[model samples]
Target: MALRRTAYHYYERRLVATLPAERLPRHVGVIADGHRRFAREMTDGEYRASYEAGMRKLEELIEWCAELGIGAVTAWVLSTENLARPAAELDPYFEVLTDLFHRLPRVAQRLHFTLTVSGSLDLLPPDLALAAKAAADQTDGIAAPTMTVNIALCYGGRQEVVDAARSLVADLVAEGVAPEDLPERIDAEGLARNLYAADLPDTDLVIRTSGESRLSGFLLWQSAFAEFAFVDPYWPAFRKVDLLRALRDFTRRERRFGK
Candidate 1:
């Protein structure tokens, strides 16, 4: 076991060394998937344990991104669709999520990153929403942060687009624009400006774990030209080597950005 661990570390170091800093992604998006399946398969349906492990893995992912000098990371921790699950299945997960939010501010401070929770907070349970907001507030005052972290809780890409459109319409109305002129005022760039994390760069790469090969509405607009890497491990089991491998693959791609 010790020998295998040593070999693994050596390989990881080599992989990191091979990646060109200039080729690394400026922004990364993660769809942290398969926690429930992992619980059923590995922990005999102990969901809280699986959730806790997944959250820990997320913290590790942030550290890894920071070390690589990635400018921003957007992680989808919970989705609007996920809220439809039975309370028995979701309550424990919510508890785990709330705990994660409580703990994340300290992590953000230590890592020198500004944290933002981007999602429909109105859709989440009151306590969970409050906890997430508090965490964001705690990290908002960081000065000249080294990186930015976005936690997508209760988020749905399509909903985000709809919200952005509504916001644009409201702004146009407030500006006293006539209804006919609204069509001309509304464009892709206009909608982009109203998105949840409008200030962040477009996603450069999106990583989804648990062998899923589809985006499923994650970062629907922002990832219009992002590369993807789908790995087989569940979120809880995702490793540093897995992330390194994804980064290596991203660096090899020739991105044309829709050209």
Candidate 2:
């Protein structure tokens, strides 16, 4: 076991050395799937413990991105569809999410990064919604943040687009803009300005684990030209080496952006 561990470290170091800092993606989006499945398989169906382990894995991901000098990261923690899960599963899940939010401000301060909660808060319980808001508000005062980490909860790509459209239309009407000019106001850039995180950059790379080959409505609008890396391990079992391998592979691919 010791020898294998040593060998793994050697390989990880080599992989890291091969990646040029300047060539790395500036924005990374991750779909953190397979937590519930992992809990079922690994913990004998212990939901809370499995979720806790998943949360720890998220911290490791953040650390790795920061070390790699990635300026922005978006993690899909909970989807809008997840809200429909059975209460027994979702109740604990909501608590965990709320706890993570409450803890995020301190994490942001310590890491010198900005935290953006991207999703529809109305779908969440009042406590959870307030926690998400508090985290964002507390982190907003930080000056010159080094990176931005987005936590996507109750988020759906189509829903986000719809919400953006609604917000834009409301703003336009509030300004007494003529209905005849409304069609011109619905451009991509104008719609984007109304998204949850309007200042966020388009995703440069997207990584999804658990052997999943498809994106389940994650970052639909923003990932139009993003490179994707799929790994087989469950979220709880994901390792730093996997992340390094993904980065190495990304450096090898050419992003043509529909060319």
For this target, which candidate reaches the highest lDDT against the unseen true structure? Answer: 1
Cα lDDT tens digits for candidate 1, 45-73:
99999999999999999999999999999
How many clashes (backbone N, Cα, C below 3 Å) per candidate? 0, 0
Worst 10 residues of 1 by lDDT: 135-144
> Cα RMSDs of all predictions?
0.8, 1.3
* Every model's TM-score: 0.98, 0.96
Q: State the local distance difference test value for candidate 1.
A: 0.95
What tens-digit string does per-residue lDDT give for candidate 2 at 1-259? 9999999989989999999988899899999989889988999998888888888888788878888889999999999999889998888878888888877888788788888888888989999999988888899899888889999989999999898999999999998999999988778988889988789889989999999999898988899999999999988889989998998999898889899
Model 2 superposed RMSD (Cα)? 1.3
lDDT of 2: 0.89
- List where candidate 2 sits over 4 angstroms from the true fold: none
List the global CA lDDT of all models.
0.95, 0.89
